[model samples]
Target chain A: MIGAGVLWWLSAPDDITRPYAADVTPDIQAGALVFAAGGCASCHAAPEAKGDAKLHLAGGLAFDSDFGTFYAPNISSDAAAGIGTWTLEDFARAVTKGVSPQGRHYYPAFPYTAYARMTPQDVADLHAYMATLPADATPSKPHDVGFPFNIRRSVGLWKFMFSDTRDVLTDAQTPQIARGRYLVEGLSHCGECHTPRNALGALDRNAWLSGAANPSGKGRIPGITPAQLDWSEADLIEYLTSGFTPDYDSAGGKMADVVANLAQLPEADRAAIAAYLKALP
Target chain B: MTGFTKTILGTGLCAALIASAGFAASHSSVTNKAVAARHAQMQMIGYHTGVLGAIAKGEMEYDSAMVDAAATNLRELAKLDGTTMWVAGTEQGATDGSRAKAEIWSDAAGFAQKFTDLENAASAMIGAADAAAVGAAMGGIGGSCKGCHQDYRGPKS
Candidate 1:
């Protein structure tokens, strides 16, 4: 029994395949909105890409943290330098499982733990939208981490401890809150940054979105769980859409990108997000 | 030996208390004024940016006059010399009630350049609003704000 269990643990599956229909047409327009809602441009766009040029996902932004500097890689459709040659199955695995086409483990900075909760249909739609973007040939940059953090295989252990493919809210009475949970817990990946992490770096799920110290050591990521945050649903919606607090202060810091993404979503979607936030325990 | 040591220690503690009272009196009142001024300046900037941002996001319909007025105010705010309002030692971790980082003082030139960029963006926005294209001009303004904020300010503590 012990030998059998060891083999099972050692041979954890590398891929969870979701087959693509050979000719199933995806809604490119809907996928475009999901791209914005996921805030891909805010991080993946070339640093100086302004105006409509922001659509180019050549990816060179560096996220400096206490762990080390993480450079966002090029996810463009250029075959030589990007994911152009990847199959739909490979893209789905990368997004949800944080695995590469070559069977390498991806750093959680990619936030697949949250993306794991995304519907496979949306993943296919997103793949369709990305196909239309202008693909640049910029090569990916290496991370600047040191010591144990650099080991890719160790990520599987971390994944085993923290990664969950389950929905954040399995039971919901209202459709609005349910939709909000999908966006927040999945595509938006708000909890990835907002929730505090354990000593081992996995999210302290108990704290949820109650905020934590920023990994950069420069500032704190303020708590947003209902216990610490008291914004009403209307105020929360306004904040999401306008980047303004009820006190008239404009949002600063990383939240600006989040607001920009939320601004693109419809008023009803924004309301749903607010409803979900308000309902969080 | 013990009596002498106790008397000296008692006198030393009393003198320390008086010295602290004097030090507290000297810094507290003066420090509050600069902090308050900085807060007021930020609020003024927020007031102008709030309206322009609302219009830019299509949350409110374009009213040329409101757009022009808010844009004008923000340009002027950007131009205002905040040297006095941003007095030294008013940063986060140094003191309460401020999120500005100490780096703002050390890198005054960098901060000034960001301010100039904001000024330039606002001026361009003013021209855009005049031509009924404030929406197009909003990106420059947002980018300018982000450029400075990414470096100088600490997190919302």
Candidate 2:
């Protein structure tokens, strides 16, 4: 235990620094969209909150899975229970690297693997936006995972095996497709649930969005890649915009919430997501 | 669509039409009977809702003719006799081709309430005339769909 603790101390996260953008007083407008795109409220808000009450980042929703129940943290700006005192670099590292302000590793359930792909500017904007949200003094619920999983240092090895920080498709010729890829792969993290995972809980990139068994241990998640799903771009857009799939199958499950979030985005952004999926070869 | 995609689409279309016709109402099978029937109906529901959804989401130019057509689709589907589609042992685990939860069979009263909710929402949407009116009704429609799905349907496979 002592050896592992020392190694954990030695394996400090290489924190990412925010580029000094002292002039552009954080774009709250863009950040609002960023917050929605990240679907932060789906996990962070009090489970039954609605209307404006959803803005409270109290964070106590229980995500029941095979591993155990994992509770989201109080991300509101509370100095004691939330991320109130975190600097931009602290926030960036926590989101992008799954490292805490105190340099401990976080569980993968936090979805930092996908958030790591976000641009520094977007992360900064998100930070600025989160600052505006109301703080909650509610204490975070503890996760119920057992021994090995509870050991925070073990996440370092997991990160080494599965972490990815690059854009899903940075080389796309069209900016629209690139934006689509960003939303689907980065902000939305659609592939996290849509694609099947290996034994390690790492996403199987080869079958990206090709479908998978629900890790939460109930039913199947459909494969959504163009090769597997035959819907046209328009059909796909309609689905994202309103949870209706081609052949008239309405989205159920968690996707219903995801579609709800996507609906908040502009029509053009939803169209871009569809175009990106269609362009997949 | 090509290969399996084309095959799947064709199968879905055929199953929906046949199920709507009720020719296979008396038929029973170990595979591809009740599940296919319900899926087909759901697809038709999807088709109708897609039109309204498109307009509501700003994916299509709103037209009165299209709105009326979609309303007709929802109204017709809302009244369809889908009770026969629920064959025994056809939920997510017992069957291979569906994500319908076993709870749909077990929780009879709950499922009925959800069905009734959808019917009411669909009825309201059908009465709507303009795209704006239809849009106003979309939230209730989505909520009713999701309410049932929360307990009775599994994630899509």
Candidate 3:
């Protein structure tokens, strides 16, 4: 029993000793773009928030899953209730490693698995931008998950088993496609919803962007594969910017939020996403 | 009553009876009809929104007459009560091709407010001075459509 406990303790991720460069001044403007791509407000902002209010990041949205109901916590700069006091390194580990400042494992619901691929510079930039947003002091609501899933340590084991860091697409033909690959697989985390998941809730890398049963229940999230979505590259870019399908049906559900974020990005970025998707076999 | 009027009323009654009888086994004809009506209205809204969008994107030339007609059509559509078309049991799983989430019926007031939002936005479009004005108003109009669809509409089945 003693040896097993020791193993469990040792299995917990080591404290992040790697320091974020202290002298490198982050570009807040670029960080804003990174924030838009990340769609941080989609989950962290209050459900009723709109327009500029989305920047608050007070975090009361509920994400229902098979394991349990997980609430997006307060990520605003509130000194006590939020991450206002966190250093850039602390924020980086939480974003990339899924470990908290106190060294606890966060549930995979945070999508740190996808964020693990982000460049450290981008992480630092994002931290700087978030620091500029308005702070909210709303306390986070506790998740309603039942054990043994409630035991946070189990996530460490799951991460060890399923957290694959290999890039999804290796044969990018251009720098544009490479940028698309990074945004899609890393910061945008499009596969989080668009891809099917195994019983354990980890994304099925084999089925990347091929669609899944909508976790919110009652309908399937449509696949965006070449076979499923035969839209032209131009069509894809327009839809991302305008939310209008070729059929003139407007986007609904969570996709509207995604469209709002994508619309803020340059047309070139949307074009890049289009090119990458078209390139997918 | 005139002979023509009587004949028309008789035909309508016969058709209604036939429809009810054909669907009597599952007794979902009323629900199906309601869902169909709502879907038709939504398609009309989409059509007008597309017209305005094309003008805004410069894909279609901005003619004042065309703009007025489309904006008026949108305003009238938004003003429609549509209460009967969104009846209970007409949610996504209850009817075919609905894509109407249960929240439409459960949170009836919120759903109604979305229509009001559309109405106000369409009113703004109608009052816009020119093509540039309409283009400026398109964001709010589109946002109102999305506001409801985001919360109340389901994925395409």
Candidate 4:
């Protein structure tokens, strides 16, 4: 029995293993669309005001915080400067496990908590798309973060406290509701902006979707609760489609860019997002 | 004699009716042209000031003197009665405009408030050519513009 158990454990596929070959067909292409709907570029790429087309995802974008300055790293596939040496498994592990190839923990600044719920297939598809991009060999800049944060190993404790390791699976609920849940928990990454963080930089689940001060300090990231905004599904859909609410108000700053991307998505997906946001507690 | 007399009378009536229609059409066309010209003038003023205000505020800084001249021209253009120029049915048809939102018509009062805010702020900037004061006024103008644009302008992807 002990020998059989060991053999089974050895043969069993791990969380990051692909059971089949990578799907690079149209379904994966559709997954790419879903990835865009999730707004990956908004944070990963350098910040520009509305409508400036530039791709600089070899991340040097800086964020100022009470703790210290954190610089996002180059995610390009360059072997030396970027993730070029990273295999599909390495990419999946980083996205789902929040651990780098060197066994170092990545800060939640990368939003891997939300990405943890992403389907392996979707993650693999994203990896495939990223691999096809031109490799930028820009050297990763060291984070200027101070004291406790500079100690990268400390992030393991942070992950233990905050990260959700479960993959999102659809229950026998209404399709619309399930879709909304998938989007909110996985791709949309609403909590990154909406949920308040504790002192240790972990999200306060009690204040989930309760709105938080904008990290950039420009303004408040508004609460999406039905109580706060009183927005109907139609209103939310229109806002997502045109960047204008039914009440004649429009989103600005980062949200404007979000809306622009959302507009490109199919109407049903936007509706699903609206449904999800409206159902939030 | 009876048929010939009736034919001549019918022709005369048709000619008179055509002449009257032509005269009315010409008159309406001229009126429309005038209204269009006035609307264009107001739009140009708004556009020019918007660009100039960006420069004055240091959000953008290009040729200062050229922007100053543009501001001056905007002030001259603003002399026209904007309310009258943007006639109800005609405003939607204006071109080279991405700033105007469909909500402008749906929520006229709110839209007017934003427009008034913009006009007042812009006029203040134009009145005081001092760079610092212009920057302050530019903030007000930018606020109003952004307030409206946020709600109305289509997303820029």
Candidate 5:
């Protein structure tokens, strides 16, 4: 038991100390683009928030999964209740390494596994941008996970065993394809829903972008592999921009929110994503 | 008279002469009939929406008459009472292939509001002068469809 305890202690991810050793001034405008690409407002904003209300980032939506219901916490600029108190290093470590400012491990429900691959520069930019958003003083909600999964220490072991951020698509030849791969594999985190999860809730990388059972247990999310989708690049560009399928079916459910965010991106970015999907072998 | 005139005259005479005529009730189950009716209603809506969407996307040449007709059809469809087809207990798991969720009945007012949004959007679209105007209206029309589906429609089975 003592040996096991020691191993567990050593497994916790180290806090990122002074992540920006040299002063690198973040571009707030570029960070807004990153914010759009990340879809930060989808889960963090109040549930069903529309228009400018989504910009508040007050964070009260409940995400139901097998383990438990995870609530998105307040990431607004409130110094008392939000990340406004966090330093750049604190934000960077939490985002890229899933380690908290207090050294606790955040549950993977936060999607840090994908955010782990984000560039340090992007993380800095995002942090700067989030600072400009409206502040909400709502206290962060506690997660309702049970028993062994509830223990934050156990998450350390899980992270040690499963946190693999290697490039999933090795053959991204063009720069556009490479950018698509970065967004898909990292900030956009499409695999969080598209890829199946193992017994431990880690994404099954081998079946990347193939849809899985809806986490809420209503119905199956459709597979988007080239074999399954079969939409031309133009069809995808149109769908991403306008939420219309080739057959005139409108996108429904959570995907509608995703399309709303993707629509805000540059047309080139949408085309790049389509090109990447086409290149998937 | 022309064939078109003869067909219109025949339809009018048939409607006048067949007043109060009774027909056999449909043999389909009540649940099946309700679900099927809603499916047909939705298809009609989709078809009209697509007609406008094609013009908005520049895939179809914009004809003022065609655009007006499609937008009018959508407004009329939205105004129709959908209660019979949206009967309670016809939600997703209660019947196969029905994507309607229980919230349709539990939160009936919210669902009705979605229809109102569609009706208003379609009414605004009726006199759109050009493809650009139609394209601008598609945002509201399509957004109303998506907003309701996001909350009240279940995933495909």
Candidate 6:
């Protein structure tokens, strides 16, 4: 029995260990840029409206979903209150597998299911960038959710139902397109906003890019699929560069802030983004 | 016809259709086009003026004279007829590939207020072309741009 237990312990997968290699610093930096593009700070950061901007990623943003009011948790580097003690493997597992450092299940509100397609290098870069932030010692806030949601283990079932743990696949036939795909599907996570959700809040893969209501309770995020946006490559490029649509109109609300960041990026990267978005099926 | 020939013919037809659609889509009200062109020109002027103003104030040092000249041009550009440029359905120009949100249309008054704010700020910059006051001008102009952009621009990613 002792020998069997030892064998089981040795064979049992450690939730934290990830299949990652070093020497991916450049890719990691690029991934950090991609993370910025994805606007992770906008949602994950504590709300500035309530006058506490210093909280950083000590998440307190409330996201009201059909499941319930889901408050974001503190993801800082605090040893006691945050993930300060977490290993790179632990961070990767949380981001890629939706498993907390302590092996607890994380709610889908954390976006790990979509982030699962991210390259390990990108994840590492994001991890590195996150590590540089000032550690806040705020304790993790409990979810206001009731019933089954209150039981954190329920996320295991949620994972089984909706998680797609595949890395972003790139085709050699179109390297630029492939880069765009990786950037969009992985770090950018565009589908999180544009793709509609089902009753279970899982993305409806078949009707991908068809447009959906914003999860933040703002206006509907329009579909940018070729069929819907009908934008030329130049149009997309201009829009990305200047935040103006080809029709000379400006985007509004959160999108405006997003454009501001994109506008500051290198033109070549913007063109690549335009090219990729146009090619989306 | 052979398969290659059929494919070529189909692609050619599709290309023609797309071209026609693009052409039709390109058409806009002549008046609106003029207004949009003027607005775009003003935007460029505002951008340059801000840069120049920064230089003049010693906060930045790129080209003070050139920036001052650009600010003059912007003052002139802002004087053009902008009556219909920011109207509903006219917020975006044919060449402007912006994701102009519906709020611009739904809340036209507030949107127009931003334009007025921009014009006022730009006009003020021209009056105070002195190095000492350039910083203030920069702030005013930037404030207007931010005011409009905050509510209207799309996400960059």
Instruction: Compare the candidates by DockQ and give the number of the best one.
Output: 2
**Candidate 5 CA-lDDT value:** 0.83
lDDT of 3 by residue, A155-187 (tens): 888887788868888799999999888888889
Q: Is candidate 2 or candidate 6 better by DockQ?
A: 2
Cα DockQ of the candidate 1 complex: 0.17
Each model's TM-score, in the order given? 0.77, 0.78, 0.87, 0.59, 0.90, 0.63
* Residue-wise C-alpha lDDT for candidate 3, range B49-157, written one tens digit per residue: 7667666765555656666787889888988888687788777877776788888878889998999998888888885666688788887788888888899998855
**Cα lDDT tens digits for candidate 6, B14-54:** 44345434433443333446444544554454445434443
Best by TM-score: 5
Better of 3 and 4 by lDDT: 3
Name the docking class for model 2: acceptable
* Cα TM-score of candidate 6: 0.63
The parts of candidate 6 lying over 4 Å away from their true place are A1-19, A22-32, A49-55, A165-173, A261-265, B1-157
Model 2 lDDT per residue over A114-149, tens place: 998887778889899999889889988888888777
Weakest lDDT window of 10 consecutive positions for candidate 3 chain A = A14-23
lDDT tens readout by residue for model 4, B43-93? 454455445543443433344454566666655564555576445554323
Tens digits of per-residue lDDT for model 4 on A1-281? Answer: 99867544443322445542355332456655665766766665654423333234566778777668778787766778777777777887788767787767777788888887777667767777666555666677777788888877667656655676453333414577667777776777777777778877777766767788778554467777777778789878867865544322346656765776777788888888788767665
Residue A36 in model 1: lDDT? 81
| True interface contacts reproduced, per candidate | 0.36, 0.57, 0.57, 0.09, 0.53, 0.21
- True lDDT of residue A77, candidate 1: 82
* Model 1: per-residue Cα lDDT over A1-281, one tens digit each: 99867645753546865464345567888888888888888888888566687888899999886678899999988887888888878888898889998888888889888888777777878888998888999998999988788877767777887787576666666999899998888898888889898887788777888888887676689888788778788879977876666544556667877787788889988998888888887
Per-prediction DockQ, in order? 0.17, 0.35, 0.27, 0.05, 0.28, 0.12
Tens-digit lDDT track for model 1 on B4-105? 644643454344344334433433433467776766566566556656665665545556666678788888888888878888878876776566877789
Candidate 1 docking category?
A: incorrect
lDDT of 2 at A2: 100
Q: Can you give the lDDT of residue B97 in candidate 2?
A: 64
Query: A22, model 5: CA deviation in Å?
Result: 3.4
Clashing pairs in 2: A210-A223, A211-A223, A248-B46, A248-B47
User: If the candidates were sorted by their TM-score against the true structure, best first, what order would they fall in?
Assistant: 5, 3, 2, 1, 6, 4
